[model samples]
Target: MKVVIFSTCVVDLEFPNVGKAMVEVLERFGCDCYLPSDQICCGQPTYNSGYEKGTQRTFRNQVDALLSVESDYIVGPAGSCVAMLREYPELLKDDPEYLGKARILAAKTYEFSQFLWRILGVENAGAELNGKATYHRSCHMTRLLGEAESPYALLEHVKGLEMVPLANAHDCCGFGGTFSAKEPEISKQMVDEKVRHIEETGAEILVSCDPGCLMNIGGRFNRLGKPIKIMHLAEVLNSNVDERRITYLKQMPV
Candidate 1:
C-alpha cells in the first residue's frame, strides 16, 4: 500500500521521534510510505481559536499536499490532527474549487493506531514494554474523532505491558490546542486533575495517543517533580518489537 505520512505541526516541530516511529511501524507492516515536504499544519490551532475563515487556505493547502502523491491512504500520528483533516470536506464545502478534493483527502486519512488496527488488521505489532502504564484518552481522539477502541485494542497485545485503567479516562487532559494558551490557569487545573488520576494508578509510564495531551500532562509532571515517563501510542507500539511475534488478522492486499 502507498501511504502518505501526515506529520502534524507538533510532531514535526516538537515531537519528531513520534513521527519517525509512526513511519517505521507503517513500513514494518508492508506499506510504502512517503512524507510530502509540502504538508503543513492541519489548522486546528487557528481554526479552534474562532478563525474559521482564516483557516481556509490552510485547509486547501493540506488537501493539495497530501494528494500531491498518488497514494491509497494518508496516516497521521496524532488523532486530534487527523480528526481535523477529516473535517476538511465540510470546512471547504462552499469552495467549488477544493470541496471535492477536500472530501477525497478526508476519506483517505486515518490516525496511526486506527490505521494499524482497522485498515491493516494488525492485532499485534510485537512491541514489548516492561512497566505499568496508564492511558489518557485525548478529548479529540475520543469525542471528536470517535476512536475510543483502536489504541487500546492494539495495546492489549503488546508483550509484557501492563495496561492500567485510568480513573475518569474520559476526561480531557486540558490540551485543547489554543485552549491551553488562552486559558492557561484553567488548563493547568484540568491537567493537574489528570495527573493526579495518573499518579493514583501508580503507573510508571503515562501513555496517550495525542502529543498535545502528552506535552500538557508530561510538562505538569516535570514541574511537580514527578517521575512519570510520557509516551505516545505509536512510540509504545514500536518499542522493543519482536519480529517473531508480529501478527496480523489478515494478509495485506496485493
Candidate 2:
C-alpha cells in the first residue's frame, strides 16, 4: 500500500523525530511510504477558531499538495487534526465545492495507531520496548475520532511494557490549540492535574499520540524535574528493546 505521512504541525516543529519514527516503523512493516514536501498545516487552527476564510489558505494548500501525490492513503500521528479534517465540511457548508473536496480527503485520513493496529492488522507489530508506561488518551482520539483501542492494541506487543490504567485517562491535557492561548490559567491548571495522573501511574514513560498534550504534560514534568519521560506513540513503536535484548534478538530475529 502507498501511504502518505501527514506529520502534524506540532509533531513537525517540536517533535520532528516522531515523524521520523513513524516513517521508520511503517517502513519496517513493509509499506511504501511517501513524505510530500509541499504538505502544510491541515487547517485545524483556523477551522477551530471560527475562521473558515482564514483556513482557506491552509486547507487549499493541503488539498493541492496531497492531490499531486497519487497515494491511496494519508496518515498522521494526530487525532485532532484528522478529526478537524473529518468535520470541517460544516465550516464549508455554504460552499459545496470545498465541502465535497474536504469530505474526500477526510474519508481517506487515518490516525497512525488506527492504521497500524486495525487496517494493517499488526497485532504484535514486532516492536518491543521494555518499560512501565501509562497512556494519556488525547481528547481527539477518544472523543472526536472515537478511536479508543488502537493504541492499546499496538502497545500490547511492546516487549515488556506494563500498561497501567491512568486515572481519568479520558480527560483533556488542556493543550487545545488556541484554547491554551486564550485561557492560559485554565490550561496550566488542567496540565497540573494531568501530571498528577502520570505520577499516580508510577510509569517510567508517559506516552501519548498528540504532541500538544505531550508538550503540555512534558512541560510540567520538566518544570518539576520529575524522573518521568514523555514520548510520542511513534517513538514508542519505533523503540526497540534495550542493549541486552538487541543482542539476543539478532541471535534470533523475532
Query: Where is model 2 more than 4 Å wrong at Cα?
Result: 241-254
Model 1 C-alpha lDDT versus the unseen true structure: 0.91
Q: List, residue by residue over 1-254, the lDDT tens digit for candidate 1.
A: 99999999999888999998998999999999999999999998899899988899888889999999999999998889999999888899899999999999999999999899989999899999999998898889888799998899889998989999999988888888888889999999999999899999999999888998899899999999999989998999899998899988765422
Score candidate 2 by lDDT: 0.80
* The best candidate in terms of lDDT: 1
Point to the candidate with the largest TM-score: 1
What ranges in model 1 sit over 4 Å off? 250-254
TM per candidate = 0.97, 0.90
Candidate 1 Cα RMSD (Å): 2.1
* Candidate 2 backbone collisions, by pair: 128-159
Clashes of 1: 0
